[model samples]
Target: METAQENRLNPFLYLTYLLEKLPQLPDPQDEKALNALLPWSPSLPLICRVFTPTK
Candidate 1:
């Protein structure tokens, strides 16, 4: 049996795995379909923060 500490996974590693599996831009329109295909979705603020220019 694995210990809790041993079972722990790095969030950044998981995020990288998820991003690699996600569809390219111009995804499906249906929310259900999108959710079914995507492991995660960033909120509007998070998306804006990532793309927004740094001054």
Candidate 2:
């Protein structure tokens, strides 16, 4: 049987750890320019589908 402490360390905790380690956001003007310069990517659609609200 799994211990209580081990059970508490779940996937959500790992996700939070990953988010915390990400680089800080850039300036809004630069961010907008970067997005405009970048090509359309399928990553956003995949992530949205993963976290989409279920009916």
Q: What is the lDDT of residue 21 in candidate 1?
A: 45
The TM-score, computed over Cα atoms with residue i paired to residue i, of candidate 2 is: 0.25
Residue by residue across 1-55, what tens digits does model 1's lDDT show?
Answer: 1221133433444455446545553664667545543323332123212233579
In angstroms, give how far residue 32 of model 1 lies from its true place. Answer: 13
Task: Return the clash pairs for model 1, or none.
Answer: none
- Expressed as tens digits, the lDDT of each residue in 1-55 for candidate 2 is 1321243323444345335433443554566544532223232222212243579
Candidate 1 has an lDDT of: 0.40
TM of each candidate vs. truth: 0.29, 0.25
Candidate 2, residue 24: Cα displacement in angstroms equals 5.6
Candidate 2: list runs displaced more than 4 Å.
1-9, 24-55
Backbone clash numbers for all candidates listed: 0, 0
